[model samples]
Target: MAAQQPSEKILVVDAQADSAKLIVLQLQEAGFAAVWARDGEAAIGMLDGDDYSLALLDIRLPKANGIEVLSHIRESGKDTAAIMMTAHGNENLAVECMKAGCVDYLSKPFAMDDMLQRVMRAMTNRRVLLQKQRLEQEKDDFVSMLSHDMKNPLTAVIGSIDIIREGRLGTVNQEQAEYLHAAIDSCNEVIAMIDNLLDIHRFEAGRMQMKIAAYSAVEILRGGTRRFTRIAEHDGIRLRERLSHETPRIAVDKNAFSRVIANLLANSVKFTPEGGEIVVSCRCLKGAEVPWTRLPSYVTVPDGFAEKDCFVQVSIRDTGSGIPPDDLGRIFERYVQSRSGVGRERGGAGLGLAFCKMAVESCGGIIWVESEAGLGSIFVILLPCYLNGTECTGK
Candidate 1:
């Protein structure tokens, strides 16, 4: 790490003029903004309102020891790195100093050059830690604002619109009902986008813990189809299910799988022209029969997976304008929308598919899509069967 920048401040707390004064002089000469405190009380006073990147203190002080000063700084929530200097034969105090939150415990007779190097490294590390903390706080604030300020109000608006359309408030004409439904659908799209953004952030940060359980693949498909039925009807699209007669149970995170289904359906609805058809289907197959070998590396299954492992395959096929073959490989990446200009105009942050991909993969499943320009697309997911399986219907 480089030396602390001139803008960064350091606090030196030691009564010994021989070492403390020389160290302070060297720090300032090395371009660091340094302060001198003759005792522990002075050090704490200096830290009250000012911000310092690092603090160097002596283990034996007049008023308070280095440990006490360090503890006070921590208790007050001050962000500063502490490096304690101990007496020459005070090896026993090394562990105590460290336990009190010192970044480095050094002996009195240490080389000035070595001390400078350690200070520089400590400052660098402290800055990096503070940066990470700021980023995490920003992420939390963003998600909270989206959920409370944006999604909540829009959700209430949608509910009121639904009530009116359902004729609870009064009788409504067909056109009025259609308009209200369209408005509701648009609000739903915004909510889904917000959810995708939050989930994407969590997944990237490795904070999305999946609770795997056996779920009925057929039930999940039916539920998703029901959710988009109204929107599809409004768009003149046919949302049909070609589910199998036998239901297959697959190990997955229920919420994650639901999001995947919703996202795929939304993408289909947005890109499909009027009169287009989308088919939601489920099938169970032997791992060897899944055509997994033909899929790209993005949809890689566990290497331990064998042909004997039974897998459940869920597919959402849309008869809309398909994705360009060249862009198929990268669509699952974050912030990547449709290759066609039409997708851009339709409005999306390009996080839905990426979230779906991660959610599926996190459950030890593989997701892939097959498409060509001018042809419709089919998004497919294959999850390891939870042993209990039933025969699946083919499309």
Candidate 2:
């Protein structure tokens, strides 16, 4: 392996001019880029002007002192590691400095080797943290680029398939039409997967913005179920809904909410055996009536809704092979799938539930699943109701 490169820029702070110069020289000789500050005020000023990997500070300094400088650094939320130099023998002062966010400390008249070692260790840690952040950013960029590039071609292919299916391109025989339909379905699945990947990438990077508006809860439920009715019938399954007439309007990103419901329906359609039954239901309930244990970790009840009298509860229940007990806890996690044979037979990218979880939580809702092997599974979603004439408070 190639030798690691040293690239940390360090700041050395001391009231004594000679001590500061000596430390800067030592750091330079050790292959570190170092800047010297004769007082805490100068150190603070330098920090604001430049990015640094670490700061070496003396506890005794003219004007502002080391503790005050460290406190300011912490308050500013800069990720620079700090090592304090203290001549005071009191352990309490050392503890106080640590509580003030000092990463390590040194005593006056410390050996050059020990000081250099501490500096190296702190810089190494900073390098690791920076590397992690960079990798995460790169991953996000890759996913975004891939999704954008694939979408155009996929859309073109789907449009062409639609044209052919409509008999616009000469007459197609039954066999040819069947194969073309399969190809179209496969293309659509790939498009859905790409969309899911993009959604997850945006969500994790905190770029997802909710376009909230008032919408009827019953209409949403009916629309979602309607889209899957024909597909369920083709598979010899029954898709139905039990929405309450008194269901209130909900303010949410209509597209996102619809996507969540579609994903749930897709999951149920995929796993439910032929002739199985699926039900989509919605009802208004009090926050206190929600089963908190069924809520996933990502979902949170908004503070504004805590005192409210009502919330919306939606459930998609299926009578099919249920999830195994061991896999229940992880079904909502990205790329996780049940180990049951059914999941293996019905192949997917395993992102539907994860996307559902994120979309629901973004609207200040909770989603969870209750399943038992060989019985059935019930996926539940709880959303805060949008009272008429009142503005919704969450996004």
Candidate 3:
């Protein structure tokens, strides 16, 4: 099969009128839209007036050197790729041109075929870069729109719930009260999901602020667990916790960290079969070396390696239908869903893991999972230990 040829726009800048005209004629003959710039100054003027996909520059020019013109193009941040032309006697000039930001260098004595090849390669690179930038901008726009659209309705629903709960309308009967409570709970869940979206925006914007303070492992777990204990009971799932008494006071953003643990616990209960077990465990580890702490082989550490440090490792291991191996990598991406197996068994927007990931990373910690199909999944979090911080003995 014959391949389709791509049409390109080319800009030619040269001091030699004959050389520039000849190249432009060749490019046009090859079906390129060729724009001519008589000198470096003229090239900059042309760029200011019009957009071109690629620019072919001559190293020797009036008013500005090709390198200077290339530097200007780069500084302008245009996606216009550049090919610098150098006379055969100025081979070193070609290398210098490349260093100055020309995408390709063509020696003056080069064949028309070689010139075309370099121009095509440069244009291809420019096109790819521009496309990537456009896609990223679209992604950012979508996230922003999603955040606003989703949060507004969720805020309204929560506000309505508050009004209903406060008896602003009227007194409620037992059945109405039950239904209102359920409505409030549902509203809270949606609010949490919307908060997840806000968390993503904050994390991406590098705006996640953590308030570091001393907190007790058992106490935080107890309060967080109590909040969700009713939900676990309503679903007939067992929420068990085993905390080490020796678990030291850790430096953490208490409220945010509590959300991390509570989200995981809630997910465990939601996914587990009615009678399944969800175990929450916290222990202080001494000399625990996690993956991120390890230096690559080529890196050598100077002396005074601190050891015997403390880290509070918390795990929410659920005996639920586990995550499939294929869906593991993408589980943390925003709005990404696991399509196969158990993910289909349980319907969700797949935002929980993404939320969990953002929350964990925001608190200067890490969260990951260990799971196998049909076995279970265990989500683990590790936080740095705090020494002699005020304990939350929970009044």
Candidate 4:
């Protein structure tokens, strides 16, 4: 049961002045502040000017009806709960009012005790709704605070590991160097996890602002893929890229674009086994060639872009264990991971792909994946080409 508020208010709207007075007297005696309205129009005017926890609306009223007032309240997004007061034969009308968002209804000639009980119940439900909203807000604030506090210490640890791996303090033997390198890698992984946590919070809170500008798609893809070459080679995997010179520049947040590419490459590297090959490729595509329906829900196109606009497509294809059909649909959701054993073995907090999806979508692009179990996966990113007055022909 929801908690009760002692200062709750109720509005009583009745065409009969006597009925309205009696109802208001009963509500006031029940410890609720009661206000009276002679008809539906007056009730609506009062509702617009004041905040009432519940409204007791009579079906029969002068000038306007209870149902019409209820519709206006709903359309205005008021949080007030409502109960309809109907005559004995108006059961059908009461049902219709309930369907139109009335919380409860009382028949005419109802006992004062029953009226008070219904009022209390409606107020309690409203209290519960407000409480739930407050709790959700608190939870988001707590997560933001925790993620921010974790970054400072993790940054210092990453810096120390970098120093040791680079031999800034002294010379080190081959075995020692290998151990240091592993330590550095582990530290970097922790830092990445911390960054993902922060980014997810910012994305959900709408605080992740993007610095949009025109940038070469080729340069972004090449630079992003180049960072992972040493890691791929170390794992005995072949990494290559194929870029089309005809690809146009894309308007996006440079840092966010880089992070999106990094996350995709990291995901591919984690799943691809030894002797596997991963290819990063880019090309131009006409809007007709793009499959909008197949795109994940996190991806959204900008409003002005249409089916005739030109786009640049970047694909990362890997020879790795692909996702199971069931998990593929939810792969980009926050904190969701594949149920496959591979996901369990390759541990993550499952925010990498989610971040990539949000970052790409923030730039008015789409990200999607195509995969079959044991046949490897292909991840694609489609971004709007910067046309700049020249007609884009997907050259």
Q: For each of the candidates, give the backbone clash count.
A: 0, 0, 0, 0
RMSD of each: 6.5, 4.2, 6.1, 5.3
Ranked by lDDT, the better of candidates 2 and 3 is: 2
- lDDT (10s digit) by residue, model 4, range 60-169: 88888999989988998988999999999999999999999999999988998888888887887888988998997897777766566766676687788778767888
The residue-by-residue lDDT of candidate 1 on 78-143, one tens digit each, is: 888899888888877877777778788778888989999988889878989999999989989989
**All candidates: TM-score:** 0.75, 0.83, 0.74, 0.74
- Which tens-of-lDDT digit does each residue in 1-395 have in candidate 2? 12235556889999888888999988888777898998989999999998788899888889878888899889999988999998858557867898878888888888998998888777777779889989988997788777778877988998999899878999988878767876776787788788888898889979988898788878988998888887788678999889998987887789989888888898888888898999999998876786666565544566765666678889999997899988888888999988877647768998988899899888777788888987879999877778783543333
Candidates by TM-score, descending order: 2, 1, 3, 4
- Model 3: lDDT to the true structure: 0.75
lDDT of each: 0.85, 0.83, 0.75, 0.84
Winner by TM-score between candidate 4 and candidate 2: 2
Q: Point out where model 4 deviates above 4 Å.
A: 1-21, 28-118, 197-208, 287-306, 389-395
Pairs with steric clashes in candidate 2? none
Ten-residue region with minimum lDDT total, candidate 4: 386-395
RMSD after Cα superposition, model 2: 4.2
- Supply the TM-score for candidate 2: 0.83
For model 3, the stretches where C-alpha displacement exceeds 4 angstroms are: 1-9, 29-33, 38-42, 60-63, 88-102, 117-121, 124-128, 187-191, 194-223, 240-259, 288-308, 323-346, 358-364, 371-376, 388-395
Count: clashes, candidate 4: 0
lDDT of 3 by residue, 262-299 (tens): 77886787668888888889997654454445322322
Clashes (candidate 3): 0
| lDDT over C-alpha atoms for residue 242 of model 2 | 92
